[model samples]
Target: MGDCVIEPEQDYKGRVGDDPPPYIKMPQNIWPKDAPFLREGLYNYYSHVFPLAMKLVRIFALAFGLEEAALDGIFKFPITGMRALHYPPMPKEECGTIGLGAHTDFSWLTMVLQDSVPALEILNKHGQWVQAAPKPNSFVCNVGQYLERQTNGRFVATVHRVRNQTGERRYSLPFFLTPDPDANIHALDSFIAAGERPQYEPFNVGDLYIRRVLPARHRHPTSVKYRDVPESEWKYELLYG
Candidate 1:
């Protein structure tokens, strides 16, 4: 397994929107690494969902008061992934425990297809924790860190967390769409004002991804060769209100 596992370089830093280094990699969790069935099924699902994501991106661009195509280029051949999550009912002893801690998504955007179970909650702009009720045939959408930076902080990524206590299993599918491998992410000029500064720093998509995912603790033995990403910068670094 180590042969295929690439390690990050010594100069790794967790900057949003930066290109990733050659050592960075995403994990594959499909059963039987050699089997193509699960891989193809997921790919086909992404194929059907990617276009919808693009359409939403177009909508997002316009909503941010920029041209429809303003953010479209960044997604060209972007890093995208979809996964099914299952959370079992929390035992009575663990009633107050959190199933998933509070955090923000690292992708440019996230679309969540949730079942009837309602456990996810988001911190709204007014500092209120709003329970995200599952709507039939609806997907909950949220802005991510990259989009927040690109918009000069106009669209703040919603902080969220989930917990299960209803004695029923909860399922959700979230699709994360990030920038292309070589795409550079800096605040768009259109969103900045004259003689004003951009709220974010420039970065490559791949590098930022590596920084966000490389765990701060419980790391693999091979990862010791690389620089460590600061615990303060992890996407879930902030405390839940």
Candidate 2:
């Protein structure tokens, strides 16, 4: 367990293509060397929260009439971490784009604990943005692409966003649960036997993380080349496709 403070104002500046911004402050080796506060918070999260989440997943798996172990391996003793984020108050003019940009998480599951600031929104199927009502003591649970693949689309990876409406600073803790980098996320035969075929080609989790998530952080100054793939092939593709 490791901990670090995320100062969004000081860490992240303008948009991704804007002038080079200052280095964002993040924790080093957050797993074993996490700060005391972070470790404590995460310990409570893992102990109290994860079991309930596991129960929910198990119920869903049983609903599909699959063995509990089918989904168990995907989440068992995973290398998960929690992120503590601080969003500062922005002027009303800049509030539109002040919070997190519309994006999906890159993990199996995410449990978000938000303060009473009330700026989070979820994108509905009709392309409308709807406000997410914050509930007390209940973390916002959302699925990710990895889980969607593991469950053969039985579970959905939803898109969510956050905005800071109040004048005060907002704090949020998002727990990201993931399997090992080399974990295989293909749908099981039992899951696929339910009249739906696998939607995606078999790909390694490490490759997805490197290609998608890692690049968003600490990008290289020059483009790095892969041995067999050409630069033209780097165009973005939806993960579910």
Each prediction's RMSD to truth: 8.2, 10.9
Please provide TM-scores, in order, for all candidate models, with all chains considered together.
0.74, 0.69
Q: Which pairs of residues collide in model 2? A: 1-31, 1-34, 2-33, 2-34, 2-35, 3-34, 3-35
**lDDT values for all models:** 0.68, 0.61
lDDT of 1: 0.68
- What lDDT tens digits, residue by residue, belong to model 2 across residues 1-241? 3111132221212212232212313433334565567666566655565556567767767876788655665543344556778888877677656478877778778888888878888888899988887789878888888878777777778788886666567888787766645466677566676666687767666567556642564343222333235533542221111
Instruction: Estimate candidate 2's RMSD in Å.
Output: 10.9
Model 1, C-alpha of 135: deviation from truth (Å): 0.8
Task: Kindly list the per-residue Cα lDDT of model 1 for residues 67-108, writing each as its tens digit.
Answer: 998877676546676777889876778764678899998888
The CA-based lDDT of model 2 is what?
A: 0.61
